[model samples]
Target: MAGVSRTVACLRFGGDDLDPDEISSVLGREPTYARRKGDVWLTPKGLRRVAKSGIWILNTDDAEPGDLDQQVAALFSGLSEDFSIWRNFARLYGGDIYTGVFLSQSNEGLSISPLTLNSIGVRGLEFGLDIYSNTDDDQKGVSEVADETLD
Candidate 1:
């Protein structure tokens, strides 16, 4: 059998910090699950089955090539759900993606977006950004254009 692999993670904002409905209006795609407790869920399956918790980085391996990769957009879309909503989030907490060390600081820093889903092609769209780890250059696991190259 194929090994278990999934690189999807849920964005964990404070419990009372956001309104799921407002997020829905921003992404133009209704969340698979939206609660007043401030959570918006999405997957290619339309709304998600939340089996895990907190920034789950799941990139499935046994499936066929599909938008499972592009579904990263759905997560990004959640951020753009509303400019005001995201703006408020950035203002209240932090902005952009936080480093692993930053997250380990005195406060529970927020996780924000750094990529823009701008281009579209017949093979679907593409994302151009870098995901790096906090380590020396030799130890760097990811860097430059997180397209399907690593996949």
Candidate 2:
């Protein structure tokens, strides 16, 4: 089995009353997924799901999922470097912006550069990780590693 399979990263912004059109206009980029408040959609399993709030997501995962630093760099690419744009967007929309990273691995780990950390901090965005361990024999051990990494 592979120790580390994939690392996906994305920027997600959500609010109770966010307008997808307005967000697109302000960000000058299209979202991978967007849902307005009250929008209803069917899940992959054919289950009906209704959006409780507005959501805009931009997936910035690199084709090569091995390097998190490269993925983060790609995430900020083509986006404005001016912090005011982000600040104004937060003020106008909602401050519920986050960098979502999903890691699928068995025992391997990765590191994000200080530059990437600084960028996320300057944007006032939360960083969230969902780590999935492939090895079922030691799920608890993997969780302990994840906990330590967070701390």
Candidate 3:
């Protein structure tokens, strides 16, 4: 399907965007929680569905930057390039998904959120963001892509 194929930060997603905590209240949960070993957030039960979080049921309308805002910023900062993409994505998609990464200003880790697409077609991507959230928790040079696991 044609959809957003890019990921970026919402530096330009607007300062007036929705707050993360408010989004959390709407969704009824914290931004991130520890994932128990050998546990999955989503599970299949017959034709029905079950999840530990609403992440799997995320809709483009709910993923908007206004709902998520830069809440991840308190947890994730120092974006080098994706900031531009975030602004563009917000203007185009107006929705997003929290990947559930948590961080304190002194934690030495980066947080990430995904922006879903508005127009899905034969030439578009399923979703896209302008930036890549780096999950290198340690100050070491190790790096892993956040979108990989979020999707």
What lDDT is reached at residue 54 by model 3?
21
The C-alpha RMSD of each candidate to the native structure, in angstroms, is 14.0, 6.9, 16.8
Better of 1 and 2 by TM-score: 2
Better of 2 and 3 by lDDT: 2
TM-scores for candidates 1 onward, in order: 0.31, 0.73, 0.20
TM-score of 3: 0.20
TM-score top scorer: 2
For residues 1-151, write the lDDT of model 1, one tens digit per residue. Answer: 2211212222222234445455456435454333443235554447554423212121222211112233444455423444565555444422232111111122222222344323112113232323223232422111111111221
lDDT of 2 by residue, 37-135 (tens): 788977545778787777777666432345556666776677777777776666655542233233355456667789887887676666676565554
- Candidate 1, which ten residues in sequence have the lowest lDDT sum? 139-148
The residue-by-residue lDDT of candidate 3 on 2-91, one tens digit each, is 222222222111123334444344334343322222334432223422222222122222222222334334222332233444444344
**Global lDDT scores for all candidate models:** 0.31, 0.60, 0.29
| Deviating ranges (above 4 Å) for candidate 2 | 1-3, 62-65, 88-106, 136-151
Query: Residue 92 CA error for candidate 1 (Å)?
Result: 4.6
lDDT assessment of candidate 3: 0.29
RMSD of 1: 14.0
Candidate 1 has an lDDT of 0.31
In model 1, which regions exceed 4 Å deviation? 1-4, 38-71, 77-85, 90-151
In angstroms, the error of model 1 at 61 is 11
